[model samples]
Target: MKQVLSGAITMLAGHPVAPSTVYRLLAKAGWRKIVPRPSHPKRSGWSRRLKSSPRR
Candidate 1:
């Protein structure tokens, strides 16, 4: 859940299931707070350290 909400990508992009389907599942499972996080407030400019590196 944290990975999905980390701003790297949308839930649908990370998960094989559709975004709406995941959302509905979460809702039905009482996982309301498991949604994506909004854009960061203070972070400005792309930081090299924030980028995800290719896994070996």
Candidate 2:
């Protein structure tokens, strides 16, 4: 954030904007936090289990 501000200041020599202002701008621009999903425990062997299980 500060790096962007410093670069902008060097280019524009404009007034200093606060970090909160930059965060607000990013939110307004639709930036979002992405998170990873948890891995499934039985991910590898579904077909093997189905074939090996006894019939109902």
Best by lDDT: 2
lDDT of 1 at 17: 51
Cα error, residue 24 of model 2, in Å, equals 0.3
Residues 1-56 of candidate 1: C-alpha lDDT, one tens digit per residue = 73364333354467455556656756777875646556666665565345655556
Pairs clashing in candidate 1? none
Displacement of the residue 54 alpha carbon in candidate 2, Å = 33
Worst 10 residues of 1 by lDDT: 2-11
| 2-43 per-residue lDDT for model 2 (tens digits) | 478556744674676666766676788788777775655667
List candidate 2 segments past 4 Å from native. Answer: 9-13, 38-56
Scored by CA lDDT, what does every candidate get? 0.56, 0.69
> Evaluated with TM-score, which candidate comes out highest?
2
For model 1, the stretches where C-alpha displacement exceeds 4 angstroms are 2-15, 34-56
